[model samples]
Target: IVGLPESLHAEPLETTTVRLPRWVGGSYCWAGAYIAGELMRAEGFTDVRYVEADRSVDQSEWIARGETDFSVNFPPNQIASIDAGVPIKVLTGLHSGCLELIAKESIRSVTDLRGKRVGVDGFNNSRHMWLTLMSAYVGLDPVNDIQWVLTKDVKPTELFIQGKIDAFLGTPPQPQELRAKKIGHT
Candidate 1:
């Protein structure tokens, strides 16, 4: 009943068709989707399937192109995809208080980031979108005000560890990992 529609509640217990559910990150990040899928299966969906994608692939594109039935991602990225003609719908937010912008010891506050380098997965991805928004909120240009480092092959955590970037915006495991190693501060 959690993720199911009211229309589905009264439907007969029979074979139903659904596009494969897709998600990003490891099991913990997508645990809700998996649990919901399993619940649907228990409720008599005989053909439910899930498609787990690698981090590098754009999971939103999977949903946009109809390769997936549903997925969770940063709201900004989803909105960008919708603006770009992706026929996807945002159901709801799963949780909050997970995303954190971390900085090394030398960088004490947001204002300290002027002329500093920040690392993100890509130039226009979800993390980068937030970074840009935050920069603008602080009266920074988001582009010319700070140096943006692309962490395509290398992750933000690794980039921070290697002293390649001054700050990084990361989520969940990355934050946890950084904390475990005492890498940065939020």
Candidate 2:
């Protein structure tokens, strides 16, 4: 991406004369993937379609529906999709260790989450799935040992701030926002 002129970035993943995949989604976490798509378009892949997916699970579903040729997703969601027979395979991992689980002072560690309420936008979403793996990593039963608090359309951070949830694993801007407010410990 070095010296990639500013103007080129303005029109990333644009539909073109050549097609890479019918549908591909982007997450803010992986800007490189988007850049790759842009480069492909620059190289004459004019027919590549772009999709905006808020969560990796959505990307998996789009793939299952034949609306997406490829996508990037977390391993837990990827495995779940495959187990659910989504007919997609992992080409490679983009990255990991980006999820940060934040909690109030009452909760000091991952193990402390047992018998506690954790917030998520919904079940099986990015936050919930990541938190599930984290719970298992600490030898806790994700399904039974912890209470999953769903905010539904409401962002979990709001619930976490209001003390409705004991903890939440926010991906990016939420963590930064929480840090600025000095609201929780991560």
Candidate 3:
């Protein structure tokens, strides 16, 4: 069922295990992928496994290299993979606009991000790309103006909390943690 988007609902396929990748621990971007794995196991479709899993910037590439069966990726990465002939397709849009830009109180708006340290999971990652677009919209030079700090799997929000960075984009758990501690303003 190539590119059918019915893998979850279709009849069970014979396989030892199906591998799925999570960007990070229960992050909003990859939550659907994780849930799908759990659902597949619950439905007896296949034994779900996670592989090549890390906070690196190339989950799409992992899929292209046959390291995993599927992944949850943002549009820019997916499109770039497809352009590189990765032989992958968008199964569905899980969710969008879930990432929240959490910044210190001194920072007011996207425009104010100029010359400030903005933490991201990785360069050109979903968080970075979205923030870059936001910077462009506010007439800031995305590349030259903002200082992007890469924390990868280390959690940029943690660094932000420690005052090592000025701003950062947080997904599910990160944002929740920030809110619970009343750390930063969104």
Candidate 4:
């Protein structure tokens, strides 16, 4: 990392707008962003406003467009955006161990995912990216080995429960819900 010029230190801007997620799947990552924005606002350093982008806009796109000052997301997703010429830098590591690849009892492992229908919220979202990486790691071509089930019309949980999908990449509330209802095994 290149060091900033010594003259860069100065009073922070007095007014700013922050962006964060309104959904639960990545909310754990949002905790830090929320506190930092709130603390800045509370300390009178800035008049902060938080905008929650709808599902139509992915967080990486928001970062690329400078619509959001900070957000937490998967590394692969961020790297892909950067490779596409998005101006983003990894400041530091926040946390990990939040994502889980959940599957039904019949699907025992990543290899079992081959020929199975996997549900994801969107076609190229982090979930989809991670699933593809995993599939490739297990010697399966993501496009041909697995049936990609886009869950744009319905949530993955509902589709999984209805037997429309055999496995999915899940986080937080959905995983908790699946466990509570005895729906699937991680």
Candidate 5:
């Protein structure tokens, strides 16, 4: 799930739009429709509808209700959706590489994350997984060593700027924005 706000729906889906996700499968399949709409525009199509959903779950809901055409999502979630009887299809993997563990201060290494409050979009997400892997690598149990803060609708950069979270696992623009604000050091 991209975690874009619902406000994005008012905008049209056009060739200029780009949808981001780790892969295309499961409940997140409708995300591919957004990408396909973009491709159609690039091929000279126009007036296409380009709308961004809040999360993979939202996309899944849209697909199940027939309100959306496609999406991009993780394999596990997709499989679960299929088992639950949501009609969907796979397209292709958009990108790879797991999330990175980041901190708001100069921590130097993962070991420094002990006792830190880590912020992630949600549990079982790529960001959360990275935090878990990093924590385990440092001999810290993710469930016990750190306080995990799940900020679902709020952007990680905003949480970092507000000092609501000590560290976060996030993707591009948010991490880049953090650097621009000097709110944290990855």
Candidate 6:
């Protein structure tokens, strides 16, 4: 079933457990975990298990242990899991597209981001990769020019709102929310 963790659905479904994919291909890694939990509870799944399997190898471990009945994973990861002898299936496509880099102030253009601190939710994820690509396209070296602030607990939007981070690399709502708050011009 298609679910959003941050969404508020009135009618909850009847489910016992919920599992999320470790990675959603081009979008982001582990980005759907929270939303999957939200979906599980919203669907009335009392037992929610979040499996951290970024690749097929990790997914195999979860299946071998019988830790979860289902998981949200990339197509390649899913294929790998199946190849590894893990009984798993694809429910549906959750998300698509790469992330974007958003700045608190008016960047005017990508060139302004040079030497600026860019906030990334995680390393090696879509956001991180997007920042790297954006930086290169803008003639900035992600490793040397832009400062990447890796945050584990707080959301990138939250950091942007609080002014703790100059730029955030992620999907919508955060950028839209920031525009709504008049904190930045998207």
Q: Which stretches of candidate 1 lie over 4 Å from their true place?
A: 1-8, 13-15, 23-27, 52-57
Error of 5 at 119 (Å): 1.3
Model 4 per-residue lDDT at 179 = 95
Cα lDDT over the full model 6:
0.64
lDDT of each residue in 133-170, candidate 3, tens digit only: 88999999999999888887787877997898999877
Candidate 6 accuracy as TM-score: 0.50
TM-score for each model = 0.78, 0.77, 0.68, 0.76, 0.52, 0.50
Model 3, poorest ten-residue lDDT window? 22-31
Model 3 regions lying over 4 Å from their true place: 1-18, 22-24, 28-31, 38-57, 95-97, 152-155
* Per-residue C-alpha lDDT of model 4 across residues 1-186, encoded as one tens digit per residue: 389643343656545555554445546667777787667665554456566665576577776676677666678777787888878886765436778888999998999998999998888777898889889998999999999999978889999999999999887888999999998999
Question: Candidate 5, 61: how far from true, in Å?
Answer: 3.7
Q: In order, what is each prediction's RMSD in angstroms?
A: 4.1, 6.0, 5.7, 5.8, 11.1, 9.8
Question: How much is 181 displaced in model 1, in angstroms?
Answer: 3.8
Model 4: pairs clashing at backbone N, Cα or C within 3 Å = none
lDDT of each: 0.77, 0.75, 0.78, 0.78, 0.64, 0.64
Pairwise TM-score winner, candidates 3 and 5: 3
Q: Would you give me the overall lDDT of model 2?
A: 0.75
lDDT of 5 by residue, 73-135 (tens): 545456556777878776654335434456767666787777877788888765576578778
How high is the lDDT of residue 91 in model 6? 73
What lDDT is obtained when candidate 5 is compared to the true structure? Answer: 0.64
lDDT for each residue of candidate 1 in 32-80, tens digit (9 for 90 to 100): 7777777777666767778765556556778766677777677777778
